[model samples]
Structure formats: C-alpha cells, structure tokens
Target chain A: MKFSFPKKVMAAALCVAAFAGSAQAAEKVYRLKMAETWQSNFPIFGDTPRNMAAMAEKMSNGRLKITIDSANKHKAAFGVFDMVRSGQYDMGHSASYYWKGKVPNTLYFTTMPFGMTAPEQYAWFYHGGGQELMDKVYNKFNLMSFPGGNTGNQMGGWFQKEINSLEDLKGLKMRIPGFAGEVLAELGAKPTNIAPGELYTALERRTIDALEWVGPSLDLRMGFHQIAPYYYTGWHEPGTELQFLVNKRTWDRLPEDLQEILRVAMRTAAYDMYIQSYHASAENLEKMLTEYPNVQVKDFPADVIKAMQDANSKLLAEKAAADPLAKEILDSQAEYMKKARHWTDVSDKAYLNNFNAE
Target chain B: MKFSFPKKVMAAALCVAAFAGSAQAAEKVYRLKMAETWQSNFPIFGDTPRNMAAMAEKMSNGRLKITIDSANKHKAAFGVFDMVRSGQYDMGHSASYYWKGKVPNTLYFTTMPFGMTAPEQYAWFYHGGGQELMDKVYNKFNLMSFPGGNTGNQMGGWFQKEINSLEDLKGLKMRIPGFAGEVLAELGAKPTNIAPGELYTALERRTIDALEWVGPSLDLRMGFHQIAPYYYTGWHEPGTELQFLVNKRTWDRLPEDLQEILRVAMRTAAYDMYIQSYHASAENLEKMLTEYPNVQVKDFPADVIKAMQDANSKLLAEKAAADPLAKEILDSQAEYMKKARHWTDVSDKAYLNNFNAE
Candidate 1:
C-alpha cells in the first residue's frame, strides 16, 4: 500500500529542496475512494463528503481525485469503520460512537451527556490535546480519525408528555441510542432503538413515547413537532461531532502536496459542515416555530436533570475504572472543558444574557 | 492592472470542460505578494497570513506562492486597502473595519456592537447573504474581501472603578475607539484614544480611567490584568472578524485551481485563528486567575447595559438613514441575528446553563 516514497521522506525532501523534486509528481493524478454513512443526497451530512472531495480536487489542480459512495451505493451504513480499516474504502465519514462496540474508547470522541458545546469541543480537539488523544486510540487500528462535523447542541428529544420530575422518567418508552440511552436506562426509562422511517409512526401510534433524533437542522423535515408537543432542550449529546476516518495505507500513498491538500480539504469541510449545521438549525427552527406554533420547547426540571447527570457520571466512572485509555481521554476532556467553559461563561454567556435581556 | 485571463470565464470554462482543459496551467508558479496589518511575528494576528501562505503553497505544490510583508516591512498599518486596490500588493491581510474612513461601508463587515458571536457571524458570512453584500462594496474598488480570522467575543474594557449605574459612565474617561466610542460619547463619557504601547502606562498613571484591548487571548500579554481591577464583559465587537483583501487583477490572472486553493487556504486559516484564539483565551484566562487573584470580571449593571444598547440602536438608525447601502447591510445583520439568537438561546445557552449548573 505504500507509495514509492514515504510521506515523511517526501516532506523532508520538499523542505530541503522546496518543490524541485515534486514537479514530476504534479503531472500524475492520484485518485482515491471514500465511503460515507449517509444516503446519497442526504442534506447536511451528505454534503460534507462531496464538499471535501470537490475542494481536494480543485486545490490539487487535478492531481488528486476523490469519489464517494454513500450508504445506498455501499450498502453499509454502520460498516464504515470495518471497511476503512480493511482498505475496502480509503476514507469514511461517520460517528466515532458507532464503533464503541468494537473499540470502547471510540465513545468519548463524539459528544457526552452534559459535556462541552460546539466551540468548547472544537477548542478541546484542536488545542486541548483531543486530537492527540484521538490519534492514540485510532493509530493502533492503522486509521486516523478527525472531527468530521458538528451538529451543534442536539435537542434532547421530542416528548409527548412534559417531564416534570424524576418520577416522569420512570417507565417512559423513549427511542434514544448509544451512550446517552445507556445513561437513561439507569434512571428506570426504557430506551429503545427505532428505525428512522418508523420513528414518526412509532411516536404517533405511541410505539415510543419519545425519540431523540437531531436538532432542528434534521428534525424540521421529520415532522416530529406535529405529534410531539414538547421539545426538550438537550442534555445528552450536547455537541455531537461526526468523525472522518482515513486508512493509513491510503494516506501513505499520497504525495506530500496532495496529502496537504487532502488534509486541509477535510479540515475545511469539517468546519464548514458545522457552520452549515448551525445555519440550517437557525433557519429550520424559525420555520418550525412559525409553522407549528404549538410546538413547545421545554427544559427538564432541576431534579430530572440532576438524576440524568448522576447516571451519566456513574457510567463514565465505571468506564474510566475498566480502561486506562478511557480514563485518560475523559480526564483530558473534563480538565480542558472546566477552563474552556469558564471562559465561555464570562465571554459568550455573559454577553448573550446581557443582549437578550435588553 | 487587469489580468490577461479573467476568473469568471475560466471558472465557466472549467465547469463545462471539467478538469480537462487546465492541466498545463498547473506547472507555472504564480507568486503573489501580501501586506499584513500586524508587525512581524505578532502572535495570532501574524500567524494567520503565514499559515494561509503555507497551506496555499503546500496544497498547490508551490504553484501558488504567497509572500507576506508585515507592517514592519511595509510601514503602513492601515494602508492595506489602498496597497491592494492599487496593485501594490496582490493581497493584504487586515481588518475590513480599518478601511471605514476610505470606504464607509467597510465598517459593517468586521463586527457590530450587540451583534452575533463567532459561529453565528461565520454562518452569516458563508451561508447568509454576507459575501454577496461584501462583493457589492468591494467590487467597484477592484478588490475582494474574505474573512481573515476571528478574535471571538472581545471583553468590554477594564475599569478603575466599578460601573454601577448610568452616572458611572458619564464623565468617565476611557480609551475606546470607533463606533463604540461614539456610543459612549452619547452617554457623556469621554472616549479618547491612546497608542497601544502607551496604554498600560496611561491606565496606570491615571491618563485614562478605563480601556479595552482584546479579550484574554491578546490582553494577557499586554499586562492589562495587573493594573485594572474590574474587567467588564463585552458589549462591543462581539465577533471581531478580520479581513483578507485580494486584488481582483491578481485573482483573475491565476488559473482556476490555484484561485480555489488560495480561497480555501484563506478560509481555513481564518477559522483556525478563531480556534487558536479560543484556546489561547482559555489558557490565558486560567493563567491570569491563578497569577492574579484580585482581577474581578464583571458585567455592566443592567441599567447601564440598557443605556448602552439604546445608544447603539440610535446610532445604527442614524447610519441607516444617512446611506441606503449602510441601511441595507445593517438591516441584513439585524435580521440574521434575530433568528440566530433565538436558536442560540434554546440550544447552546440552555445546554451551557444546565451543564454549568450541575
């Protein structure tokens, strides 16, 4: 899988001689393939891979080409990790948490219940050693994982009933998934998984009392507001960042310049997706409110929030005790978040409160 | 000053022919010169242009070479617009607001008092109608402006005495500049200006009662925490976005792929600076609190905040009345912020409040 020259050697030679040795490499076009976890033409999520591929192609001046296969074409929505690691695909765009079954440490890279917000999480990734920690987890599998995109603070879920206290969560049938669902299960709630296509009928027919999809960015088109009167503010998955995975074998084949182009393209597309999600959320939320004026946005009572937080803490503590790597990532995120959150409080929170009050 | 080949025609041709016709253009190196507003080695501000140049060069395999001249070399901290517009430099890295004196509409692009935060502002710039409005302003001058970097939410200022009421702002002498100063002047505060190098001494020697630099990201280095006891939260320049200006002539001369490389490079670099600033602010704020425990971060009292907000609205109204274009730009921002803020409240703000409370 390795190219004629290694990346490190190419980078070093390029540094010493500048672009003198790489002129020949520029004439040859290198093409790579990617597999995404979303269906073809799937709005914000689907746009990320296409955006990344287009930017890489344009930036490399036709030297690098990338083609993408979505879930429909690949027939593997949840098989992204396996496919990427086995070299069935050069890269993948999916969530890290999806691989928690195979690699438990993958759970921490996405979002956590009552964890950092979008900006805070990004600061953690780029500056607070999150990237290095991610490398430690993924490097063993010969894969590199990067922050693919963010859905901002996801809404908790659409609830048919208002959650007044801890008693309300008892025996509640909710379609929640992943780590957050595990946290809720500890609180006497029945957290089930329902197919996306069945979610609306399930909620309407009371197959599930509530379901946590995404925020308004994806939720508006789902028509959840029509059946669920109360849209609870988020606690679980505050900043749900998706993941980008690159197989080491494929990466080792890229020329230094094309490698740089691919890296920057992925990075830019990741950030762009976050902004796109934010814009979509804002636009969609406004549209939802105007169209469905009865859709009430609610916050869980203090006691309910407290119960959920306690459950989350217990789960994290158990995970931390079981694995040293899990302990390290959690500790890093907690420490970074404490300081970053303080700054957020004084800067954005304070300003927002003042401006909103005015 | 016109380039031989125009970008629009090239872009159209590339779209019709795909990458079929542009292979030969990739071999020729197109070097561009850029002038920045900061001095050589000025921390975050200086890092942006260098980062952009490095990415553009590496991504384009050195076909797009951008060399930067800082204020130390160019001797014009505020002359970026003129230099780029006249083709003295192919590009310039500076704040768009700095060109307010020369181009009155330039002030609206950087940031506004009581406006959107970094992510919101970025969403507006990229997804909202901001880029089109910017083109309307810059096209006639033969320049293109892009978001260079963001400084996040700036701190209000440091005060010698606490601002408890509207009376406190009256007759208070402060070294604040631009539109914020005009708002302060409306409240009978003496808005003065001082050179950056002399600011610390001026505040200490009672030459000024208060002053604001940037937030903790850049302010800690300036030693503002040592002298000022009361550090106020921001009301002005919530998301202070810097600008990168490109001479249209230079942009048109480049092959389409190189142009795309340069554009994406500038964009990624700008977003990186914002994350860099966020990380630095958190790290520096931690440092400041640990090293100097006496520094008290305060929000302006509700009454004072109301007065300032009122003054801001009044000024914006006057500006809108004076010029139709100013009215157009200001209205666009106001409308964007209104919907965006509502989403921010229910999403990030609510989640942050819940997490911080726990």
Candidate 2:
C-alpha cells in the first residue's frame, strides 16, 4: 500500500511536469536587438523605432522585447544594412537610398525625385506591387525591407539666390544628396554632401550656396530661416519614405505570432510617423511664419524646373540600361505612378484647386 | 508512513490542479461580436472591421476573437450605435455622421464641407485635440469611437447635367446626405437621402437630378457612369472617415494587453484602408475613362462653388451659435486646418503644380 501511494504521487508529478513544460514553451519570451541610423533623441526619425518597439511589446503581452541601439551607440549610421544583413543586429531603421552605392537597386524603394506623393506612394507599396519589387531586391541580400515612415513633400532647398533659369544652376555649389545630387550635377551644378552639423556653417560661409534639409518638420529647428532668405519649394524627394530592415534569419526564428505583431507595429508606426511629420510641419511652419516672416517660399521657375526634369529623366534612363532589374523596377514604378497621379489630379488636386479659389 | 504517502499524493494532485487553473486563465479566449453598417460582402467598408479583427486575433495568438455581423444579418444598418451602446453588440463599424441625429455632436467627427483632406485630418485627429473632442461626444453614449477608415476625397456626386451658375441649382433635386444636404437646401435645391439600393432607380426615373456617391473606388462598381454623363469634383465630405465603436463595458472587461492589441489593430486597419481606397480609385478610374470615353469629369463653376461655400459658412455659423461645445469644436478645426493647409500649400500643392508643368 505504501509503494502504491508513492507510485501514484510520482505519476501525478510527472504529468504535471509535462503540462508545465508546454506552458513554459507557450510563455517563452523573445529578445531582439535593433540598430537605427539616427542619433538618440532625434525627433521624428528616432521616434519611429521606439514607437514600433513599444507597440510590439504591449500587443504581444511582453512576449516580444526589442532593444534599440542608435547611431551613437552603434557608431554605424550608414552601416545599418551590413549590420542587419550579417546578423550583428536583427533589424535596422534607415533610408533605402543610403545603400545605393552597395546595391544600386535599393534607390528605387525610397522616394524617387519627382515621384508620387505620400498617399500615392503608400498605395503603390501596399497594393500596386511596389512591395513585391522591393522584396525582389532585398531578398538577394538576406534581408526584408518595409516602408518605415514618410516625410511629406520636402522643401526644394534654401537657396541664397533665386533660380531664374538653367543658367543660374551653372557652377552653383549645393548640398544635396542621393540621386537628386546626381541630377543637379548633370545640369552643370557642383553638388556636394556635407555633414549635418556642418550644413549651417557651410551655407553661412558660402562653402555651399544652397542646402536642402527636410521640410518645416525638421528645418525650423535647424534655424535655417535665419541664414537663407529664399526657401524654394520641392522638386526632388516629394514623399521621402524611410525603410525598416530585418535579417532573414532573425525573422525566420520568430514564432508566427511575434512576426505578425512586429509587422503590424512597424506598419502602424510608419503611418503614425507620417501624420506626426505632417503635424510638426504645420506647427513649425506656423511658428516660422509668425516669428520670421522673411522666409521666402518660392517655386523654381518653370524653365529651371523643366531643366531639372530632363536631367532626372536622362539619369534614370542610364541606370535602367545598365541593369535588367533596375529597368524592371523603374518600369513598374512609372506604370503605377501614371495611374495613381491621374487619380490624384482628379481627386485631391482638383479639390485643392477649387478650395483655393474660395 | 502509510498516511504520509497518501498525504503527499493528495498534495501533488492539488498543486497540479492549481497550476493547470492558472494556465487555462492565461489562455482564456475572448470572443467578441461586431455589428457593421455595411451589408455582407460590402467592399472597402466591410473589409475594414474584418481586417482589424484578424490582426487582433493573430497578434494576441488567438486569445482575442471577433465575429462580425453585417447589416443584412443584423437587419439594422442604422442601429449600429444603439446596438453597441446598449451592449447588444460588443462593437460596431459605421460612420459617426449616421448617429448625428441622435447625438448632434457626432456630426463633426466625420468630414466637414470645405474641411481638411485625409492626411491633414489624420494629423488633426492624432496630434491636435480632435480625438479628445471625439471622446467627449462618444463617452456620453457609453461607447468608444475610433477612425474606422477613410474614403480619400468623395466625388461631388454624379450629375446628369453640368452646374454652371446658381440658377442651375434652383429647385434642383439632388441626393446628398448630412450637413452637405442642409447647405444645398439653402440654395433653393431639394436635397434628399435615398437608400443605396434605390439610388440608381431614383436617378434613372428622374426622381433625382443628381446624386453623389463615393469616388471612383466604389462608383465604378455601381455603374454610375452609364447613367450620369457629368461627374463633378468634391467639396463636401473631402475626407469622409468612417467610425469604429466599442462598448465601454466590453472595453473595460478586456485585459491590458488585449486592449492594446485591439487598439493597434484598428489603427493599422484604418491606415491600410486609406491606401486600399487610393489603389482602388486609381485602378477603377483608369477603367472608367477607358471604357466610357463619353463620360465627362467636371468641376462646378466658380459662381456655383462660391455660392455653395457661402451657404456652408452660414449653416456652420448657426451651429456654432447654438451650443458652446459646437463652437469649441468648430473653432478648433478652423484653427488646425488653417495651419495645416498653409503647409499643404507650400509642400504638396507646390510640388504637384510644378510636376504638372512638366
């Protein structure tokens, strides 16, 4: 009878242990580390990664935890792609165009010069096969890329003098980056890239005659209006979208539920950042106009605009001819933009024009 | 020793039972019922709630489950607010304006005539004090409301004839609901609301001279182009946002993690629907233009637009004078829109105009 009671106790204990094992498995927590291109405490750009991480943790009931390392910590602002791809970091937040030197096709995923607006670009990404083309490019690098956030139509740049015609661009030294810089170079302008910290000094001392930062969202804080009188409207990077990178191995290791939680969080954060940027721009622009009314918001004259367009088209054609995948991605974007821009013209464009009259 | 062995057996079994109880609690399923204003299989509007529910379930790892009943199943297209408020359904998906007759302040939560566009309105809701105002209105009814989806800029209805001047609006019969209908009535037009099923027949029988529907995203499927030759651009309901309703009791009953899951899911779905609507509009508009070459897209004449604006302002001034809360909400919107629109003018509007010139 003693042996029987002890045997029953052992059997019950074993069953409970088995049940507890499965329960622990269900309750297991996953920890991931991420790298972001921006420095700590950067306004809209830095907020995106932290926002995404917080949402994921809350939605997943603490089952998923993500820790972020900013450029200050990682000391790899431009190395986000390589760090995430090599699994040194499980994820990254950066702009896709930053990797263009290493992977030329990466340029198409970010906003192209004179491309679709924010809403149009989002539609193209989610519904018009832009995501598929992005996958085709990023899959080759053992990474997954997603639309991180959008900076609405960026300002053209703060110019010292008005751009009257194509002649004004000749020998003009400007701090513009990415494909836009290349487009400017084609028009006999000397395009240069300067560190963000040096931009104000560079423009002030005539090291560069013009500089393009983000729009009112980030620009008003940079105190650019104090130095530049001619604040030109945008022609390049109309809807500049940032990117999120995930290492394929890191993604594959996650449970299905965590994967979905991370995805939805990133998406919501991206959309939220766009609205946040819009709000900041509106608020900051109002402040700028009310305080310093001398910021001349000008559109580049028609001749100057036309010349920039021609230069952009020529550069795109050369890139397309050099690589088959580049041609495919460019063609897809063009086709999607044609349909989307038409709708934009009829809907928001028409409404805005009509409302302006009132 | 024999008594001691039996005691250990009992204690082990009891401990297992206790552990099993906590595990079950952790895995408890929360099944919620959602009632939608749309009929079964309704396109974009119906898809939103289902999308939100799926995300919540997946993110919560099946702890939260939501089942939806459409208008046909519930037999109460307009009773969504009442059902959700009374706890007959845990949630509802509908437009806030539909409840304006019952809760007068519900009107402003949807779009307004000559108001901000989608992106601008989203900024107002999230960043400005719009969400707080929305809460004050919905809280009285024991419900929580959220932005369900956005239908970009609604078309200014399909018209059988062009509106050239104020005279054309005199005694005209049109189908436009809510505040826009009231505005039109001030200009000697008869504005009526017709059931969706009966709108096509009413227009064909000359019972209505003009009727507004959503833009090309949904209008093409309704075959409005075949019957209406002149389609006008939108001024009223520029960014018609739908609403999601949750019973306060149901919300209070959820765990914190589930609440966050539901909140994030609905938010992501709302943004997704905006992009989806954009894509559908672009695709369907292309089809409409290609298939129906005779259909003309027109903007209301300057005089007609000006008259409509004046009438809208008069109606708004009367509302603001009627109640203190109404005045507060109106003043808030006007202030936010002014700042947002100025930024819009310098950014998106300038970019589009420059791009159009090329």
Every candidate's lDDT: 0.90, 0.92
Off by over 4 Å in 1: A1-24, B1-24
Off by over 4 Å in 2: A2-22, B1-22
Kindly list the per-residue Cα lDDT of model 2 for residues A87-189, writing each as its tens digit. 9999999999999999999999989998989999999999989999999999989999999999999999999988888899999999998899999999999
**TM-score of every candidate relative to the true structure:** 0.94, 0.97
Candidate with the greatest DockQ versus the true structure: 2
Deviation in Å, model 2, residue B93 alpha carbon: 0.3
Candidate 1 local Cα displacement, residue B285, angstroms:
0.5
Give i-RMS (Å) per prediction. 8.5, 1.8
TM-score of 1: 0.94
TM accuracy, model 2: 0.97
Fraction of native A-B contacts kept, per candidate? 0.66, 0.77
* lDDT (Cα, tens digit) per residue for candidate 2, span B77-130: 999999999999999999999988898889998899999999999999999999
